[model samples]
Target chain A: MPYAIEVTDVKKTFSGKQEVRALDGVSFNVEEGTVFGLLGPNGSGKTTAVRILTTILNADSGSALVLGHDVAKQADLVRSLIGLAGQYAAVDENLTGRENLTMVGRLNHLPKSYVAGRAKELLEQFDLADSGNRTLKTYSGGMRRRLDLAAALVARPTVLFLDEPTTGLDPQSRNDMWEVIESLVGEGTTVLLTTQYLEEADRLANTLSVLDHGRVIAEGTPAQLKSDLGATVLEVGLHDNDDVARTASVLNAIGPHAPNISGRVVEVTVDNGPVDAMEALRSLDQAGITPTTFTLREPSLDDAFLALTGHRTEDGDGEDGSAAKGSGGAGDRAGQPESATVPVGGNR
Target chain B: MTTTISIPTVTGAPLATGVGARVRWAISDTLTVTKRNLIAITRIPEALFFSTVQPIMFVLLFRYVFGGAIHPGHGINYVNYLMPGIFVQTVAFGAIQTSIGLAEDLQKGLIERFRALPMARSAVLAGRTTADLCRNVMVVIVMTGVGFLVGYRPTTGVLPYLAGTGLILLFAYALSWGFALIGLSAPNSETAQVMSFPLLFPLTFASSAFVPLADMPSWLRGFATYQPVSVVVTACRSLMLGGPTSHWVVQAVAWTVGLLIVLPPFAVWRYRTRT
Candidate 1:
C-alpha cells in the first residue's frame, strides 16, 4: 500500500522565555488506508507532529508529505485531501451541529449542492441526526465529539488526523468513538491518530510510534510492541493510592524485574505469569497485604510506554491517576494519558 | 429546524488546476466563509444586540444629553455635525470586534481548523472584514434612524449622503484589517479587547468625533486634526452638511487606502507565521 503521510527528520523548536524543542528530528510514515498511532504520555511532541503533518504548524527543518504533496510547498493540495479533528472539537458553540458541519464543507469549497446533504448523512452516521439542529453547547461531550468527527468528514477527506479523539470521554463514549473510527477505516480513509491512551492505540491503530522527549522511542504493530517489551505483566490493583509502594515490594520478591508503580496499581514483569502471580499473591496474603484485584496478563503498550518514558504510566496526574482503568486482558490495557503539555507547551 | 436538504443533481466536474481555477476558488471560498460569519451573528443574538445597542446609546446620550453644551459652529447644527462624526466613530469602533472575534477564534483553536483546510489563507481575514463591513452598514443605518428620531437632519442631497456612507464603510473595512493584526497577535479574546481599547480609545476621543478640534489644546489639535479618524470625520461632516469639501474627502480616501495597503500583509504574515 502507498503511504499517505510521511515525515523525515522533522524539527520544530519554539522560542519563548525558554526554547522548547517540540520535535527533534522526528520521523514517521503512515500507510494509506491504515491507522497510524502517535503514542506519547504527555508533551511528547505527538500533537506537534500531527500539527506539522496537517500543515497547521511548519517544522523548523525537514519535509512532510501528505498524499505525495509536500506540506509546506503544496499545502493547499495536501489540505484538500486531509481532514483534522483537533484536540479540542473546534466547532462553534453558538452554531448548531448541522451548521458546524456545513461550515467545514463550505471552507473546503465543497459543492453547495451536496454539502448540506453530506452534513446530514454524516450526522446520521455518527448517531447525531436527532441533535443536529441543537447548538454545540447543548450537546453532551460525546455528541460534540461526534459532531467534530462528522465535520471532518464533510468533504470525505482521504486522510484524517484525530488528535486524542477520546481524551475526556466516558468509557461507553470512548468505545463508540472507537467504533466510529473503525468504521471509517473500513471505508479506506487513512488515519493519523495521536493519543495518550494505550488501549485506544491498541484497539484502533494498525501500527504505533511511541514518542518521548520529542523523539520516537519505539514503533511497531500493537502485538510487536507488546512482545518486544519482552516481559509478562503482573498487575496488582489495591484499595487506594496509599497501598502502591507496599504492594510493589511484595511483587518484587517474585518478579525478576523491578515493579513499576503507577498510582494505585503495581505492575511487575515476571519470568512466568502463572507461577509468579500465585507466589506473589501468597506472599502478599501472608503479609496481610491483600490486593483488591490481581491479574496476570501479557505485556501491553503501557509497559512499553513506562519503559520508554521512565515514568509510571500514571499520567503524572495526582487526582485521576489512582482511578486509571484496569486492563485485565493482554489485548486491551486501560490507561488514558491525560492531556500532557511538554514541559514547555508551544505552537498549540 | 429539520428542513429537507436538496439532493445535489449537479456534482460538478473538477476544474483543471491552474491560476484561473485558484483565483476562482479564492473568491467562492471567501464568500462561503463570510456567509458562515454572518450566519453566526444571527445565532448569537446577544452579540448583535450589544453591537447595535452601544452605538444607539451613544447617539441618544450625545444627541439629547450633550447636544446643548457642545457647539460645532453657529449654524452647523450640532446634531448634523455630531451625527456624521458618530457614524465615522461607530464604524471605526467596529474594528475592535474584528480583533476580538479573531482572537476568540484563535484562542479556541478554531483558526487552526481553518488553517488546516485547503481554503485560502486570506479568506479568514477577508470574511471577517466583510462581515464587519456588513455590520457597520447596519449599525450606521440604525444610528441614522436614531439621529432622525432625535432631530438630526443632513442638509446634503442623496448622492453626498451615499458617498459619506461608502467612505465610512471603506474606512471601517480598512481599519478592521489593522485591528485584525491586533487580534491575531493577542493571546486571547480578553487581551484582544483590552489591547484594542487603549489604542482606539485615543483615536476616537482625541479626534473631532464628539467635539470640535478647535476647543482642544494646541498641543493635541495637530494630532486630533491630522489623524485618520479625524480626517474621515471631517470628510463625512463635509459630505453630510455641505461644508467646505476641499481635500478632506481625498485625504480620508487616501488614509483608508494607505491602511489597506499597509495592514493586510502584516495581518496575513502574522496569521501565516503565528506558531
Candidate 2:
C-alpha cells in the first residue's frame, strides 16, 4: 500500500436545528511514515474528518479507507490499523496512569503478558513512570495529555490520528509532544494530524491540506506553500494612519499582489526581498508616506495561509474577515498589532 | 523531559471471525471495560461510601420517621414491609449510575476513543451495565445488613431470600440498559442524571416501593398496583415472608424479562449509532 490512509470525496451533514456540513466532499491521502496535517480553525471540519477516518463516525456520502480497508464497510479492520488521540485527553481520571494504558491494551486484545510490560515501557517513555501508580485525577493537564497519547500507542497501531494534540498545552508541553510525534515518525508511523497551529504544521507536516469551512483551500509542502506566497513579506508600518492607502497603492506597483493594509501597516508579499525592500522604501518616501517601521522578511506559513484563505487561521468562522477588508474603522487599532505579529520569521 | 525513546512497532489487535470467536472477543472486551469501571469506583472510595450510605439513610428515614404513620396491611411489621420496598428503590436509583458514568465517558471523549478501537461496540454498554450491576449487589448486601440491624427479619428461609435478591438485581440490570440509552443520548453527565431521575422518581414513588397501593389516591392505585416496581416489591415481600403464592412473582419476572429483551437491543443500537 502506497498510502496508509485514503479519504475519497467524503461528505457528512450533521442534522440539528441547523444542518452543518461538517465534511463537504473532503479528500486526502496520507503516505506511509509521513505526517499529513489537516489545518483548519474551529468548526472548519478538521475534527469531523478525523472522526470519519477513525471509524467513530460514518461519512454520509463517499468513502474512506485505512491501509486498504474501507472505514465504513471494513470498520473493524480499519480500526485495528489506526490509533486516535483526540482533542480531549480520553484517559480515565479515576484510573492510575499505568492502569489506563493497560486497560486500553487489553481492550485492543494484546496478549496479557505483553500488555503489562508494554504499559510499563510506555509509562516510562512518556515520563510518567514515577507517577504510574497515582490516579490520573492527581496528574497535571500535560501529564494527562501525555498519558492519553501513550494509551493510543498501547497497541502500536501503524497509522495514528492526533486531533489537535497540543492545542491547549503550555509551550513546554507542546514542544515535548512535537518531539514525541517526530520520534514516532522516525520509527515509521504514519500520522494524520489535525491542528489549528500554523507553526506546528510548518514544523511537522511533510504535506498539508489547509481546510476552511469544510473545503480544502490549499494543499502543498510548507516550503512550496511559502514560496507560493512569494519570497518576501514586505511590511511597512506608516507613521500616520492617513497614509495607509498611499502605502498600499505604492507597494501595489512594486509587487504582483495587492498590499494588505491594516491600520498604519501595509504588508505585501514580493518576488524579491532586498530589491523590493529598497523599492518599497523609495516609493513610500516619494509618495510622502514615511514608514515608522519597514520589515523585509521571508514569508512564513502564516503569510501563506493568509494569502490562501484571505483570513488568519486563529480567527473563528464568525469573526473571519476577508483580506481585502483588512482592518477598517474601529477594529483597525486592535487588528494592527495582530497583523504585525503574522510574519514572525526572518524579520530584518 | 525531552527524552527520545525508540518506538517499536508491535502487532495490532487480532481480528475476530465467526460467531463463537466474536462472542468470546466481545465478552473479553466487556470484562476489560468492566474492570476499568470497577477500579475507578475503588480508587474513589467516596463513590462506594456514598452509594451504601444513601440506602442506609433511606432505611433510617423511612423506619423511624415514616414508619409510625404508614401501614402496609395484613398485620405485617412496618420494617419488613419497608425493607423489600427499600431494596427495590435503592437498586432502581443505583441504575442511574449507568447513565451518569456513560454520559461522563461520552463527554470526556472516552467513548470516541473506545469506538475507534478494534474492540467490540457492545462491550462499552455491556461493561458499564455490568459494573453498575456489581455496585447494586454491594448496596443490596449493605442494605440487608442495615435491614437486620433495624429489627427486620425474613420469615422465609435462605433460599427464598436469595431468590428475592436475585429478582431485584435482575430488574435493576434490565433498568440499567434503559439508563445506558439515556446516557448515550444526553449531552453531558448532569443532563443524563436529570433525564433519568424524573423517569425513575414516579416509577419508584407512585408504585408500592414506599406506600401500599390502597394508601395512594384512587387514580394512582391502578398504576401503583400493577406497575413493574410494585410487582417486583410485592413479589420480594411474598418471597421473604411465606405468603399465598400470588402471581406477582410471575408478573415481576415477565416485566423484567420483557425489559431485558427490549431495552438491551435499543441500548446497543444507540451505542452503535451515537456520534
Candidate 3:
C-alpha cells in the first residue's frame, strides 16, 4: 500500500528560557486510507509532530512528506493536500458556522461557485443545518467541534490531521466525533490522529504508536500491544495503604514484569491467568496482607499503556483512566495559554 | 439557514501555477476574510457603535469643552479646525482594530489555521488592514455628519472633500500595517491593545490633531509640526478649508508613501516568522 504520509527522523527543539525538544527524532509512516494514532501523555510531543506534518512548524532537522510533497520545501503543496483540526476548535466564534466553513473552503482555493453549496452540504452532514446561520458564540462545545471538523473537510482533503481532537469533549460528543472519523475513513480518506485516550486509539486507529518523552516507544495494533503485555492482570486491592508496597513485592515474583501500583491497588500482568491468581492470593496471605479485593481479568490497552510508559494515561487517582476527560489528565497542564510555541515540557 | 443542502459536486483539482493565478487567489482570499470580519462587526454592532461613539465624544468634547478656550489666528472657526483633526484622530485610532483583531485571531488559533491553508500568506494581514480601512471609512462618514451638526462646513467642493477623505484613509491604512506588525508580535489580544496604545497616544497627542502648533512650547513645535499625523491633519485642513494644496498635501502624500513602503514588508515578515 502506498503511504499517505511519511515522517522520517523529524526533530524540532524550541529554545527559550528553557529548551524543549518537542520532537526528538520521531519517525512514523501512515498507509493510505487508514487511521494512524499517535498515543502519548500530554506534552510528549504529539502536537509538535502534527504541527510539523501540517506544515505549521518546520522541523529543526529531518524531513516530512505529505502525499509525496515535502512539508518544508513544498509547504504550499502539502498544505493543499492535508487538513488539520487542532486541539482547540480553531473556528471563528464571531462568524456563523456557515460563514466559517465557506471561509475555509475559499482559503483552500475551492471554486468560488462550488464553495457555498459545499458549505451547506457540510453543515447538514455535521447536523449543524439549524444553527448554521447563528454565530458560533451560541453553539455548544460539541456543535463547534462538529463545525471545526466540517471546516477541515471543506475541500475533501485526502489526508486529515486531528491533534487531540476529542481531548475536551464529553462522552457522547467523543463518540459522535469517532463516528464522523469512521465515516470519513469509509470514504477512503487517510487520517493521522493524536490522542491521550487509549480507548480512542483502540477504537479508531488501525495501528498505534505509543510515545513517551518525545520518542515512539512502541508501535502496533491495539490487540498486538495488549496481547504482548500479558494474558491477564492480577489486581490486588489492599485494605491498608502501607501494605501496598509489601503486596507489590509479594506479587513481583509471579509475573516477568514488575508490579504497578495506584493508590492501595497493586496490579501485575501475568502469563498464566489461574496459576498467577492462585499464587498471588497465597503469597499475599502468607505475607499477612489481607486483600480488600482481588480480580484476574484480561489485559487491556490501558494495562499495556501503563506497562510501556511506566505511567497511567489518565490522572493516577481516577478509577478508570479511559473514562477520565479534559486537560486535567495526568501530564496535561492547565495554567499556561496554548500558543504557537511548542507545547511546553514542564509536565515532567 | 437553508433547510435543504444540495448534494454538491466535489472537486480536488490541482492548484494553478503562474503569477496571475497567484494574484487572483490572494485577492479572492483577502476578500473572503474581509467579508468574515465585516460579518462579525454586524453581529456585534456595539463594537461599531463604540468605535464611532468615541470620535463623537471627542467631537463634543473639543467643540464645546475646548473650542472656546483656544482661538485660531487664521480666523477659522474652532469647529472647522477641530473637525479635520477629529477625522485624522478617528482613523488613526481605528487602525488599532487591525492589531487587536489579528491578536485575537492569533490567540484563538485561527491564525494557525490560516497558515495551514493553501492560500496566499499575505491575505490574512491584507484582509485585516483592509477591513479596518473599510471600518475607518464608515467612521469618517459618521464623524462628518456629526461635524455638520456642530456647524463645521467644508469650503472646498465635493472633489476636494473626497480627496481629503481619501488622504486620511490612506494614512490610516498605512498605520494599520504598522499595527499589524504589533498584532502578530503580541502574545494575545489584550497585550496587543496594551502595546498599541503607548505608540498611539504619543503620535496622536504630540501632533497637531487638537490645538494649533504655535501655542505649544518651542521644544515641542518642530516634532509636532512635521510629524505624519500633524502633516496629514494639516493636509486635510488645506484640502477642505481652501489653502495652498501643494506643500502640506505633498508632505502628507510623501509620508503615506514612505510608510506604505516600509511597514508592509516588515509586517509580512513578522507574520511569516511568527512560529
> How high is each candidate's TM-score?
0.87, 0.91, 0.90
Q: What are the candidates' individual DockQ scores? A: 0.38, 0.49, 0.43
Candidate 2, what DockQ?
A: 0.49
How does model 3 score by TM-score?
0.90
Q: lDDT score, residue B12, model 1?
A: 16
Name the weakest run of 10 consecutive residues (lDDT summed) in model 1 chain A.
Answer: A321-330
lDDT of 3 by residue, A266-289 (tens): 998898889888888888889888
DockQ of 1: 0.38
lDDT of 3 by residue, B1-275 (tens): 22321232443424756677777788998998889888888888999999999999999999999889978769898899889999999998888899999999987889889988988888999988888888888899999999999999999999999999999999999999999999998877999999999988878989888899989999999999999999999999999998898899999999999999999999988888777
Q: Give the lDDT of residue B11 in candidate 1.
A: 25
TM-score for candidate 1: 0.87
| lDDT comparison, 1 vs 2, better candidate | 2
Mark the 10 consecutive residues where model 2 chain A has the least summed lDDT: A321-330
Question: What is the CAPRI rating of model 2's predicted complex?
Answer: acceptable
The sequence of per-residue lDDT tens digits that candidate 1 reaches over residues A1-348 is 788888899897766544556777888889989999988765567777888888888888998998889999988777877888966888888788988988888777767767888887998899998998888889999888888888888877889999889988999999999999999999889999988877788799998888765677677787666554544888899997767777888888774577887678888877677888789978888878878888888666567666555544434422111111111111112353332323211221
How many clashing pairs in candidate 1? 1
